[model samples]
Target: MSRERVSFTELTDVSQKYWPEASVGVSLIAPAIYRLHEYLNRLARELFKQYNLQSAEFETLCALRNSPEPYRITPTELYRKLLVSSGGMTKILLRLEDKELIERPANLADARSRLVALTPKGKSLIEKVTAQLIEQEAELVARIDQPGQLEQHLLRWLAQIESHQDDKGPHL
Candidate 1:
């Protein structure tokens, strides 16, 4: 026997009976994006756990690894790059320092600011973990393929959205 298909409207009506007060104005895009974000976070958390690391630690390592010449960054710089609050960055740095995974050095630029850099041991560990993480990430993306192309398309979409930011502000 063939089953009859239920349209979205039918599902919405059925949902109201069970949900009672759920707004019908909900859009699929928001929920789908949220689910995708959660899925990626879970996968990342699992992968990082294999190295005894977290996403925040991995990001800090990458930042240090990518730094030019001196291979160091200030807490303020790290905070800006990671989009984390100052207090949160300080806690992260403290944790990494406790692990001896990174070092805090006197900043030549300004005495008030301290510079953060990977220790020799930290560098070795980051190199090892990063190699494994890269392979894992590649595998994850391979399931979908053309991740670079997808990233480019997403970048374009994001740029378009960002372009409209000023439109909401008051005109001069």
Candidate 2:
């Protein structure tokens, strides 16, 4: 199926009319970034739904899958890695446990914390879902004429933004 191509002309026009003091690049880049985020999020949500997983749940599984042998990590570590709150991580872990996709066992090192690990079923499901997501992402990026070049540019842009995160004043 064909879709209408996105363009920045309207953004530029509106910026010029209502916010002439701002750089036109701001209008172009911000909306493009937001739209790109929305599009990718929509695709990810669809993929997660197909696998009976929420985005957070999938992320938690991935974190476990990437960990050392036995594929286990502490709840605090998982929350930190996923940039989520402890309470939220606890809820996600509880849901996955109920679904028999994950387990929470008392931590030997820290009695105050618990270790999270994938069940056999969780491992199987994550493997399948991750493979499908990789395929979908490959297909999506393949649409671009120079996917590698696009990736490099995006990475550089992101790095620049991240490097300036600690600055007290706006660097953009």
The candidate maximizing lDDT is 2
* Candidate 2 error regions (>4 Å): 1-27, 166-172
Whole-model Cα lDDT of every candidate shown, in order: 0.80, 0.87
Task: Name the lDDT of candidate 1.
Answer: 0.80
- Per-residue accuracy of model 2 over 1-172 as CA lDDT, tens digit each: 9687545677667778999888645546666778777778888899999888999999999999999979999887889999999899989999999999998878899999789999999999999999988898888888889888988998999898888877845665
Writing each residue's lDDT as its tens digit, candidate 1 over 65-164 gives 8888467988888889898899988888888899898999999889997899989877888888778767866777789878889889878987877777
Tell me which residue pairs clash in candidate 1: none
lDDT of 2: 0.87
- Off by more than 4 A, model 1: 1-30, 145-149, 165-172
The C-alpha RMSD of each candidate to the native structure, in angstroms, is 7.0, 3.6
lDDT of 1 at 87: 91
Report how far off residue 120 is in candidate 1 (Å). 2.2
